[model samples]
Target: MTAQGLLGAGVQLVLVVAGAPLLVGLMRQVRARLEGRAGAGVGQPWRDVRKLFGKDPVTPRGTSEVFRAAPLVTVATTVAVVAVVPFVSTSTVPEPGADLFVVVALLTAGAVATALAGLDTGTAFGGMGASRAITILALVEPTLLVAVLALSVRVGSTDIADIVSATLADPARVTSPAGVLAAAGLALAIVAETGRLPVDNPSTHLELTMVHEAMVLEYAGPDLALVELASAMRLTVFLGLWSTLFLPWGVATGTGVAELALGAVLIVVKIAVLGAALAAAEVFVAKLRLFRVPELLAGSFLLTVLAVVAALVPA
Candidate 1:
């Protein structure tokens, strides 16, 4: 990597760390507006993080070392994911294998670590949350994998870089019926994976309705901050992946300075629009009954499978 490339990568790291909170803040602000309530400022999440960092952590009695290490592992995985995911542009940054499958796997690793930590706490809520989270993961993962397969089949490579390049090269791929179906499926998956509404509400603290929040209720101090920040990073990675794969209109294909700048701007705009849409969704839709959650995920799976079949059709 040239100096500029290295600098761009460093910029991505900082943004993932800082911008993740901003994304969460924006979502909350928009959701509040949709509900006709004055939302918390976009800085609220940052404030929460700062507070968590300053407070001293109190470990639950009998908690193992696993409980202590889980938060760090989770954050590290998410940070690494931000590096691999082509957020600003497909042409920028370094990727291993460029495979969409690899990106999905890395995300799964982060989720698994957090879920295990949840179980490690030995609290009733934590175990309950972990079980529910695993159920959702089981339902969502296959659909994501299948969707990637569908996209790979169309573009003739599982590599995301090639996939983006193919879409950019043709541009007409955007209009393909199969592509549209996959986009819809992927959008739903993003909501589910990120613990967004109609799946699980990220903002809720009610134990009965909580999934992700329930898992981390016992965490305190810097450990809590790491988990919270990891959640934010997870959200950003999914949004960034979506931007690169489906709406990569402007991204650096090489190390060109101007192209990288344009790519960065485009990424910001896309995520802003997406965050607003997510906020609007949360305002209008209630969380699905926990039992009904499977149905929703199953619907996404069927749609993705249909998309794959649709791609096989001559267009």
Candidate 2:
């Protein structure tokens, strides 16, 4: 690997792992202020994660090895997400090499790992969360894949670097009817996939309203910390994908350090916009009842189909 590739890969991983907590904290602060309450500081999530790491972990009795290993596996899968989706640059890590299919698969893998861990504990809440999560994911995964399929169809490639490079070269490609629909579809899918409002409430501890919390009910201390960090990172990864695929204005096509730094700034700005938009949207929208959630996802699926059809049209 060239020095730039290695450096770029390392930077991508660091941003996802370290900076992810800040995104969570930012969302919380924005939500709180919008609701007329002073919120925790943006650094609060980092403190929370720190506290989690300091505490000792507890393993549930009678649980097999999977329960014990779930946190690591979940975080690892999330870290893998940073590799496939370009945040700092269009270039990918030389080893795994980014592909659209691989990106979708890795994103799904974190949920599957956690769901299995939920069932592994033999706890009712964990099992319930896992089941509900799986149901939601069934809808989410297809929506995400089809949305990307629409994007790939336009550029004739699934590699993030190639797609972004091509789009940069011809800014007009992203202005097509299909691109608009796909962008909208992806926005909805990001909300659902990241467990945001109108889908699942990340702040709610109530099992009745929570899809993610239920699965991690059995986790405590650092184990819980790992799960939470991974969750935050997962959300950040989705936002990164959004920034890169639809709005990759400053993403580096060259290996120059100066270009890479500018790309980093641009990516951060895009993600910040996404975070604020999500916080604002959550304030006005009520969480959909579990059954109604599918309807929303189905709408995104339809949009994806339209996006692909629109892409096939001659400009």
Per-model TM-score versus the true fold: 0.96, 0.97
1-315 per-residue lDDT for model 1 (tens digits): 567776666667887798889999999999888778998899899999999999998898878888888889888877776776666656445645457887788888888877888899899999999999998998899989999988888788988878888988988776687788788888889899989999998877988999999889889999999999999988888888887788878867876788778777788788878887888878889899999988888888888899899889888
The positional error of residue 225 in candidate 1, measured at the CA in angstroms, is: 0.6
lDDT (tens digit, per residue) of candidate 2 on 1-315? 578866877888887788889988888999999999999999999999999999998988988888878888878887777865667776644654578888889878888889989998898898899999899899988888898889888688787778888889988777878888999898898898888999998888996887889988888999999998999988989898887888888888766788777877777788878998898889999999999999999999999999999888877
Model 1's lDDT to the true fold?
0.84
Model 2 bad stretches (over 4 Å): 92-96
Query: Candidate 1: TM-score?
Result: 0.96
Alpha-carbon RMSD, candidate 1: 1.3
Candidate lDDT (C-alpha), each:
0.84, 0.85
